[model samples]
Every structure is written in structure tokens, then in C-alpha cells.
Target: MALRMKVTYLDGREEVVTILPPIFMAAEKHFKRDGGLSERNKVASTYYMTWQALQKFGREENDFDAFLELIEEIEDAEDEAEDPTGPAPQPDESSS
Candidate 1:
């Protein structure tokens, strides 16, 4: 199954976009950084991912450094159309 991303912008918009191959490559390349999550690498990786998302789904085409500044967060997209918490259990009424 294809993975999806939940992109939250600083302006409070959340979009769930598919992580297809091309989009994923741009982010994954830098994400494989060997520095073990240094603060600098973290920022860089976030920049790349946000930029790639903007290029793919957004109207941006050039260097999206400024757009990266507008992102709040990015993470795996959960199924918003369904209840992930599931339903509560039912009691046995046949004992009555």
C-alpha cells in the first residue's frame, strides 16, 4: 500500500497527500542523513520534505525555501474518513 503524509501548514491547513515515488525520493535522500538526528540535520530534512510536498501538490516550482518556513509539521497520514479508535465493547444483556 502507498504511504500518505499529513502536512500541517503554519496557516492551519492540513492536507493528506500520497507519498508517491518521485515525491518520496527528494525527502528520503536527505532523510537518510548519517548524523543521527542532529539538530541541524533535523531542520534540513524537514526543509526537504516540505519543499518536495509543495512542489508535488502545491503551485510552487522553484526553490521553496520560503515555503518551508510556512510549514508547522509533517507526519504519516491517518485515515480521517474512518474511526481509528474503533467501537466500544457491548455488554451481555441475555443474562436478564
Candidate 2:
């Protein structure tokens, strides 16, 4: 799935643009490469890189719903791989 960013101009105009996931994935890989850094620092650096890249691509904000879905999918896939019998987590009722 393509990672998308919503760009809003100074004049209040907005547009959605695709940002290659590999870019963010690369930042994560880099963070993992250096195990010496504190976990907080690694996570912060990765997110910082993500934001910088979004700005470089002219994105104003992230599509939070899509991001959450992506995270859920990844977690589900990992769970399936690790334990086939594991049930997926239920969505929060309050969110509905």
C-alpha cells in the first residue's frame, strides 16, 4: 500500500500526495542499524526523519486513519506468522 500525505498550502489549499513507504522504512532500518542509541532516541529520530521527508515532499499532515490501519495490518500479519491460533484484537467500542 502506498503511504499518502495530505498537503495544505499557505493559502488553505489542500492536496493528497503519495509518499513512497520505502523512505520511512529506510529511516526505521537506519534506526535499527545503530543499537547503541537509546530506544527513545531511535524512535524519535525515525519519526523526525519521517516528518522531514513529509515536509520535503510538501506534506502538511499525515492521514492518521490510514496510518492506523497500516499498523493494524502489520500487527495482524506478525501475529498470524507467530501464532496461527491467535485471535485479532477487537476494535474499541467507544471509537465507533
TM-score of candidate 2 versus the correct structure, residues matched by position:
0.28
* Model 2 lDDT tens row, 35-74: 5335667545534444545555665355534433322111
Best by TM-score: 1
How well does candidate 1 match the true structure in TM-score terms? Answer: 0.51
lDDT of 1 by residue, 1-96 (tens): 345667788899866666566655666665555643356676666556656765777744667677667778877665654345768778989987
Q: lDDT of all predictions, in order shown?
A: 0.64, 0.46
Q: What's the TM-score of each model vs. the native?
A: 0.51, 0.28
Total backbone clashes of candidate 2, pairs 3 or more residues apart or in separate chains: 0
